[model samples]
Target: MSYMKEFTKGLVKENPTLVSLLGMCPTLAITITVQNALGMGAAATFVLLCSNIAISLLKKIIPSQVRLPAYIVIIAGFVTFVGMILQAFLPDIYDALGIYLPLITVNCIILGRAEMFASKNGVGASALDGLGMGLGFTLAMLAVSSVREIIGNGSWFGIKLAPDFIQPMTIFIMPAGGFFVLGCVIALVNRISDRNAPVRTGCAACPNKDGCAGCGTDSDVKEAK
Candidate 1:
């Protein structure tokens, strides 16, 4: 495939959070507010871009047996770098991100891109994929967090939307709200994306209901729903 096609796949086709549904932990954990969501997204993007580039550049030199570990180290190094940068430059974000920043090391989005795309693709293509996926993830997180914050807190970036008697949901500003918003956004996006296009549902590899996991094997899977 052309480089553009390779890159675009990560944006909408294989969007890390929206389509693939990977990296739910950070997505749900940091999306309580728009700022937190944006911070986590940017940090993940930086890590994803750097790791994909490094993995693509050294894919051939690294033995297949140790590729996974090598990728983890590369990803972890970038995450740590972002952590320090945030701490020094954006102390507020750094403090808010907290332990979640370290969690970026294990974010499936980074590892999945490195193993599935970066390892076999060219550096340019890998970089593009990383950027696309990073941006997509960021968009998803922003979408969910924005809705939550607007309704749950009656504010967007600290500006109140509902004036008087606007008692916020309150829950939308908490951890549980994150999951609720995430699931709702995913479902909403899926519906919109599938409306005009022929869509398939169900997870072929899963033992439970279809679309339970992030895998896209649902295309050929048979389902009752």
Candidate 2:
């Protein structure tokens, strides 16, 4: 139950937005403003945390064949709960988030993490994993929306930074903007990862020791018995 493992897992290995690439349906659908993006992120985090813990607790009792359906039911329940609570308490955010709130049920990030990590970990670990992954997803959404909002609206979080920016790029607020932002982030991350990768020779024990350069995974040979 290492803290680093939980924190780093979502940032890279299972980044809800970029690597795992889950939950893009609403990400691209509702991120019209930073506010919407933030609201969606918070809603998602709440659902993810609850669903993960529930599933992990019931993992041993649930049958493998019915797992998918069961997971959805649990997820949909939490999604609905969050929606009702938000609508009653925070009408503004609730309205802005709109249908995207219920859309959380099908968000692959929730399902993916439930299936991959939470169901396998203990309750405490599952909770921490959900927190980390949810926060990571939220951060990524905030970042993407920030760029689009700034460039497209000439403002940050509706603050009106440049009152007269000579007409902002309206396209950045459109559907195309979402795709562009997602792609750019992916490319930037991949490029940085490649550059930071360690130089390697022909070694079997090194992570990249297998010199997977020419024929990928070549040098990734594991120790034999």
Candidate 3:
């Protein structure tokens, strides 16, 4: 694919958070405010970009048996580096993000791209993929947070917007509100894009078929059938 395609696909076509449903943990948790969403998005994008490049460079040397563990180590190192930078320079955001900052090491978007794309592609392509996916993830967070903050707190980025007669619904900032907003956003995106849900035809048709246990083992496949 062209470089532009690789970079643009994640924006909407294969968005990590909205379309693929990756990284929902931090998405739902930190999206109560726009500042928190931006902070988390920036941190995650940094880690994803660095880790994708590093993994692509090391793919040849890292054995298949240990690739997963090695990828985790590389991802964790970048996550740690990001954490220190955040703590020193952006302490408020660092504290606001809390454990979710460090949890980026295990984020499915990073690892999935490493396993499915970065390890198989050249460094330039991997970097673009990482950047695209990261930006997509960030945009998704911003969308969710914007709705939550505006409706829940009657503000945008902490600035009050509601009139004196209007009351902000406290529920929009709550956990239940996160789910509701996420579902609504996903529905809206689907409607706007007019995309149909993917059809699942079992192991043989799965993208991860090569690594899937059922597809990897004849006995398992027979049993599943």
Candidate 4:
């Protein structure tokens, strides 16, 4: 793919959270508030970008036998760097993210890109891929958090929208509300992307084609082998 295509695909077509359904832990756990969602998104994006670049630059030297381990080490290094930066400069966000921040080291979005794209592509293309996926993940977080925050707390980014007299629906910020909002968003994206998209069955016959575990087609298994 061209650099532009590589960069733009993740914005919607291959969005890590919305489309691919990767990185659900942070997506559901930290989206209780807009600020937390934004903080987590930014931290993940930084790690994704840095790790993609590092992995792409070192792909040739890293042995295929140990590439996965190497990718984890590199990704963990960047995640730690971002964590420290957040801790030093944005202490509140750092605390809000808490364990999820370091958990970015294993976030499928970062490791998936490293293994699938960065290991095979040039630095420039890999960087763009990371940028696109990162932004796409961030946008998804914003969308879910916006709905949850608005309905749950009558606010946006901590700024109240409704007057003092108006009552907020507290359920929207709870765990159940997260599932409801996420399902709605996923359905909406699928409907818009392909109104006639076929209903998929099991992984052996899945249609997503993005190579996610337990959701990929049989062809992916063959290719991996």
Candidate 5:
């Protein structure tokens, strides 16, 4: 695939949060406010970019048996770096994010890309994939947060937007609200993209299909027969 395709696919075609449904924990938790969303997005993006490049470069050197552990260690290092930077310069956001910030180390989006794309692609392509996925994740957070904050708190990024007569719907900022908004957004995205519910057809659609052995393919069944 072209470099452009690598960078652009994550924006919508394969959005980690919206389309693929990765990283729901942080997405739902930190999206109560736009500032939290921005901070989390930026921190996650930085970690994703750095880890993807590092993983891609070291993929050949790292043993396959231990590659998952190695990827976690690398991702954790960057997550730690991000935590320190946030604590030092943006203490408010750091505190607001709480444990969710550090939990980026285990974010499925980062690890999934590391395994599925970074470990198999060149550094340049991996970097672009990371960036695109990061942006996609960020944009998804922003979208969810904007709706929640606006409707829930009658504010956008802490600025009040609703008229005096309007009452903010507190539920939109609650855990239940987060799920509702996320489901609505995902549905909207699918509608806009003309996509139906995904169908399971063995491993053909999986990125790791080539190496995964948990499921047998038609060819494998034929061969066995």
Candidate 6:
């Protein structure tokens, strides 16, 4: 695939949060405000970019049997770097993000790409994939946080949107609000994509690209038969 395709797929086609539904923890937690979303998004993106590049560069050297552990160590290093940077310069965001910031080390989106794309692709391609996926994740955060912040707090990015005469729905800013807003956003995305299909737990449409374990293909089924 072209470099542009590598980058563009993450934006909407296989958005980590929206389409793939990878990182729901941060998606629902820190997105109560746009500022928090921006911070988390930027931090996670930086980690993803750095980790993907490192993994791609070391792919040839990493033994196949130990690639997963090696990838985790690489990803953890970047995540720690990002956390320290945030704690030193952006203390407020760092505090607000709290443990969730460190939890990015285990974010499914980052690990999924490391395994499915970066490990197999060239450095340039892996970097683009990381950038694309990061942006897609950020966009999803912004979308959910913006809606919640506005309706829940009557504010956008901490600026009051509704006049003092109108009261905001407190529930929108709470955990319940996150779920409601996320569901709406997902539905909207599905509608725009012309797919109103029912949700399924199966990995039939997973974007793992290379292949996902336990999601046997026709060949595997035939072999068993």
Output the number of the lDDT-best candidate. Answer: 5
After superposition, candidate 4 runs with Cα above 4 Å error: 199-225
For 94-193, candidate 4 gives per-residue lDDT tens digits of: 8998999989988988998998789889999989999999999999999999999999999999997999898899999999999999989988888888
**Of the pair 3 and 5, which is ahead by lDDT?**
5
lDDT of each: 0.83, 0.79, 0.89, 0.87, 0.91, 0.90
* lDDT ranking, best first: 5, 6, 3, 4, 1, 2
lDDT of 3 at 73: 96
**TM-score against truth, every candidate:** 0.85, 0.83, 0.90, 0.89, 0.91, 0.91
Q: Which sections of candidate 1 miss by over 4 Å?
A: 195-225
lDDT per residue as tens, model 1, 1-225: 787776676666667887777898888787778888898889999999999999999999999889889999999999989998889998998998999999999999899888777888889998988998899899888999899999888888767788878789999988888888888987887787673333544343222322234443455455434
Q: List the residue pairs that clash in candidate 6.
A: none
* Residue pairs in clash, model 3: none
Clashing pairs in 1: 203-210
lDDT of 4 at 211: 40
User: In lDDT terms, how accurate is model 2?
Assistant: 0.79
Residue range 64-135, candidate 5, lDDT tens digits: 999999999999999999899989998998999999998999999999999889999999999999999999
Worst 10 residues of 1 by lDDT: 204-213
**lDDT score for residue 180 of model 5:** 100
Cα displacement (Å) at residue 222, model 5: 15
* Deviation in Å, model 5, residue 186 alpha carbon: 0.5
Tens digit of per-residue lDDT, candidate 6, span 162-216: 9998999999989999999999999999889887563643345556536476467
- What lDDT is reached at residue 113 by model 1? 84
